[model samples]
Target: MGRWVCRLGPALLLALTAVLAIRPDWNEQLFLLGHQSARLLPAVFWRLVSVFGDWKTVIALLFPLAWQQPQRLPALLAGTALAILLALLLKGGFAVPRPPLVLPVGTVQLLDALPGNGSFPSGHAMASALLATAWSAHPKVGRWGAGSLAMVAGLVALSRLAIGVHWPLDVLAGALVGWGVMRLALRHAAPQGWPEEVAQRLLALLSAVLLLAVVFTAVKDWPRHHEEYWLRLVIGTGVALGGLLRFRR
Candidate 1:
C-alpha cells in the first residue's frame, strides 16, 4: 500500500499539473462539480469536518500521536513542514484568486471573510492529507483504521469546496502534494530504540503547549461565530487533552 502511494502519488501530481496548464478552464467545471457535490451533504456536517483539516487541529493530533509511535515523528514533522513551505511559496507565487473572487457574488457559500491569503493550493487540504497519511501509516493501525482516516481526509478536502473557499484543483493539488511528500518521507521512519526517548519527551511537552493553546482559543478569544470555529475549539480541546493524558502516563 505504502509502496504504491510512494510511486504513484507524485505521478498523479504531475499529471494534474499538466492538465491545469493545458486546459486551465477545465478546473472551473470540475470546481463547479465538486462544489455542487459538496452541497448535497448537510452544511453543518461539512462545517464540522472542515475544522479537522485546520493546522491547529493537526498540531493537536500530531504530538500525542507521535508520543504513541515515536519513530515516525521526525519524518512526519519533516513532511508536514516541507508541505507547508511549498504551499506558502506556491500560494504566494501563483496568487490564484479564490472562488469568491472568481465567481460572481452569491455564487459561493462563505463561512468567513476571504482575507490575507491567495488561493491556489488549499492549506487545509494539505494539512489534512499529511496528517491522515501519517496516521494511516501507523504500525498499530489496521486497514480499517487507515481507510477511515483516508475517507475523513477526503471529506475535509471536499469541505473546503463546500464552504466555497477552494477550487477543485486547489484541493486536489494540495492533497497530492501532502500525501506524496509524507508517503515518500516514511522510507526513513523505521524505529530505532533507546535514542528516541528525548524526542518523545519533547513531543510530550509540545502536546501540553498545544493543549493550552486550544483552551485559550476556546475561552478568551471571542469565538469566530461559525460552526467550524466552535467545532475546532471543541475537537481541538478534546484531542489536546487526550494527547496530554497519553504522554502523562
Candidate 2:
C-alpha cells in the first residue's frame, strides 16, 4: 500500500504539470459542468459537501487520526504545511482570476459572500488532499482510509467548481501539490515513544472540542451562512493549544 502511494505521487504531479502546460479549454468546460450540476442538485446538499473541505472540518477529522496514531502527526503537519506553501506560491505566481471575475456576471453562484483571491491551485482542494494523503499513510488506515479520503477530497475539489470559485486546473494542481508533499513527508513520520501518551491526551481533548463545534455549526446553520472562517479559527486555536501541551511536556 505504502509503496504504491509513493509511486503514484510523482505520476500525479507530472500529470498536473502536463495538463497545465497544454493549457486546454478543459477548465472552462469543467467549470460549466459544475455550474450546471449545482443547478440540478439541491443547494443545501452542496453546502454541506463544501464544509467537508473546509479548514475546520479538515482539522477536526485530522486531529483524531494524529491523536490515535502519534507517528502520523509529523507527516500530517509537514504535508499540510507544504500544501499551504505550495498552494500560496502557485496562486500568487499565476495570479489567475476566479470564475466570477472572469466569467459573465450572474453566471457563477458563490456559496459564500467572502472576498475572492487568486484562482490557480484551489486551496481547499489542496488542503483536503493533504489531510487524506497523510491519513492514508498510517498503517492503521491503509488503502481503504486513503480511498475514502480521496473521495472526500474529490468532493472538495468539485465543491470549488460548484461554488464557482476555481478552475479544474486549479483543483488538479492543488491535488498534485497535496499528494506529492504527503509522499515526501511519509518518509519521516517516525514516532517518539516518550511523548506519545502526553500528545494523545492533549489532542484527544481538542478533538472532542471540534466534535462539539460540528454539532454547533449544524444546529446554527452556519454552513448556509458560509461562516467557514470563524469555524476554522476556533478549531485552529484548539489545535494550537493541543500542540503547546504536547510540546511543553
Candidate 3:
C-alpha cells in the first residue's frame, strides 16, 4: 500500500493539475462557490479554518508526524523550499493584477492586500496542496488531513477571488504546483528514527519565535500593501525552518 501510494502520488497530482489547468471555466464556478460559502460561514469560523488551510499551519501540523520519521524531513523540506521558490518565481514572472486592479469587483473583506501583479497561481492554494501531499503518506490521518486541507484550499482560493486578488486559473495553477511538490516529497520520504522529542521541542520553539518576528514585522509595517506578502514569507520561513530543525539531533 505504501509503495502504491508513493507511485500513485505523482500520477494523482499530475491528473489534478491537468484538470484544473484545462478547465479554467470550472475553476471560475468553483471559485464562486467558495465565495458564496465564505459569505454563508461565520467570519470567525472561516478565519479559523483558513488558518488550517494556510501553508504554515499545514507545516506545523506535519512537524510531529515527520519528526517521528526523520528521514522524511528532507522530502518535506525540499517540497516546502520548492513551493516557496516557485511561488516567488510565478509571482514575479506573471505580475498579474488583482481583480480590482483589472476589473471592477465588489470587495470580500480581505485579510490581505491585492498584490500588484498577475494572479496566475494562488500561493495559498499551492501551499495548502503541498502540506496535504506531505501528509498523504499516513493512511490513518491522510484522509482527514487531505479533506481538511481541501476545505482550507477551497476557502483560500475563493478568498482570493472574494478579495479580487486572483483569477480562477491562478488558484488552480497554485493548487497544481502544491500537489506536485507534495508528491515529490512523499516519493522520497526517509525512514523513521528515534523519539526526537527534544528535536520537536526545539523546532516548536523556533517556529514560535519566527512567527512572533513575522507578526511584529507586519504590525510595525501596518497599512503597507506589502504586509500580506511579508506575512506569508515569514510563515513559509517558519515552516521550512521548523522542518529542518526536526531533523537535527
The C-alpha TM-scores of every prediction are 0.85, 0.75, 0.66
Q: For residues 61-162, write the lDDT of model 3, one tens digit per residue.
A: 667556555556667767888888898898889786655554336533554555565577778778766776666666566555656655566666566665
Residue ranges of candidate 3 with Cα displaced over 4 Å: 1-37, 42-48, 53-55, 105-112, 142-145, 189-215, 218-249
- Model 3 backbone overlap count: 9
Per residue, candidate 1 scores C-alpha lDDT tens digits across 1-249 of 444444465576668766975776887777778777777778788778887778888867776567667777778677877888998999999999998898888878775556569787888888888888888777777666766776788788888888888887888888888887787777654435225767757666777787788877767656455667776777777876766676674
Q: Write the per-residue lDDT of candidate 2 for residues 135-211, one digit (tens) a residue.
A: 77677766666667777887888877887788888888887777777777777654343376655665656555665
Itemize residue pairs with steric clashes in candidate 2: none
Report the lDDT of model 1 for residue 205: 77
Best candidate, TM-score-wise? 1
Q: Which model scores highest in lDDT? A: 1
* Residue pair clashes in candidate 3: 71-190, 72-190, 95-117, 95-118, 96-117, 96-118, 97-117, 97-118, 120-170
